[model samples]
Target: MGEGRLFESIGRALGLPPEAVARFGVDGPAEAAVLVETALRASGFRTDVTLYIDASRARALTSVEVATRVAPLLGEEVLVSPPADDPAVATSWFLITPGGERFRAREASPGNDSDCVEIDRASLRPG
Candidate 1:
């Protein structure tokens, strides 16, 4: 799915239209955090959401986040599984950067549970 479509889908699930999503206030990181927190909760995530502004990738201040309800593993030595939600409709995690850029997280390797490579920006495509 395209970015617009992805967020539109998410917006629908969130009962937030495109205008509402944009109205979450995106002028700064504080605003971004509010936007993200609201989205995650509406998506049925009960775990803590952590946000990070990563400039290490492609020299851009990307809003990298991890939904503990989704990708909970913190070490390569542990094995994990996705929550009991359909990945087809509900995304495991979300990435939103400046410029209203958004992406859905996908596993780098489907069966490989180990490593920090599980969820990667490189794994993100249009959606």
Candidate 2:
């Protein structure tokens, strides 16, 4: 799928508005997308979504910036991880809802050999 469409699909899964998702690709396109499902927490289980954007063409915004900007729209408290100095390493960041739903974001290239857990598109829908 095209980058725009991919972002839109991700936005819907995250329950984000189209405008908010558009900000992700303002400077560059997202090269890859992945959705992961982990064991249920004490609160509940939420699908974790990650997208890799071309850093060279994207803005240097931090995870805090992105989470804070999107939190208000979702009416939830979003937390972020500490920044990483190296670009080659995965800087983990998470968006957690009041209900304990967690969303993680990471920076990586599409060609990276890291194994990503894949799920069908239908799984993106809210359960």
Candidate 3:
């Protein structure tokens, strides 16, 4: 589906007009984070994404499961790293979410602005 349609659905799910959600399409990473958070809340799940950070620098955005919902809208395939994987190296394991969003779950050092944000594994568990 086209990017406009995808955000429209997400916006509808969040009780917002398509125009509102469509705005995020051209927005930055911060908008993507807001999109995920909005979708998770609309799904009737907890919105608290905290308490899952493994390291002081592990930036937990949403859970793997929550992200799964957005994955379909992103594209055909989404790659998520297993929780058991070792901490990330400069060149190491990573997850590629829908829309080509790539990130590592753990990192030895602070990530740059271009790196992907981590998610909590516990967020993937079925309730």
The number of the candidate with the highest TM-score is 2
- How many pairs of residues in model 3 come into backbone collision? 0
Q: Write the per-residue lDDT of candidate 1 for residues 5-123, one digit (tens) a residue.
A: 43343334333444333323346334221143222222122223222322232123222322211122221111123334546434354544333344566545445433233455576
The lDDT-based order of candidates, best leading, equals 2, 3, 1
lDDT of 3 at 101: 56
What does each candidate score in C-alpha RMSD? 15.6, 12.5, 13.1
Best by lDDT: 2
Clashing pairs in 2: none
Give all TM-scores, in the order shown. Answer: 0.25, 0.34, 0.29
Q: For model 1, which pairs clash?
A: none
Q: What are the lDDT scores of the predictions, listed in order? A: 0.34, 0.42, 0.39
State the displacement of the C-alpha of residue 71, model 1, in Å, after optimal TM-score superposition.
16
Least lDDT summed over 10 consecutive residues: which range in candidate 3? 44-53
Q: By the lDDT metric, which is better: model 1 or model 3?
A: 3
TM-score of 3: 0.29
Colliding pairs, model 3: none
Tens-digit per-residue lDDT, 40-97, candidate 2: 2222112233444334544445655555544554555554564576452354445445
Total clashes, candidate 1? 0
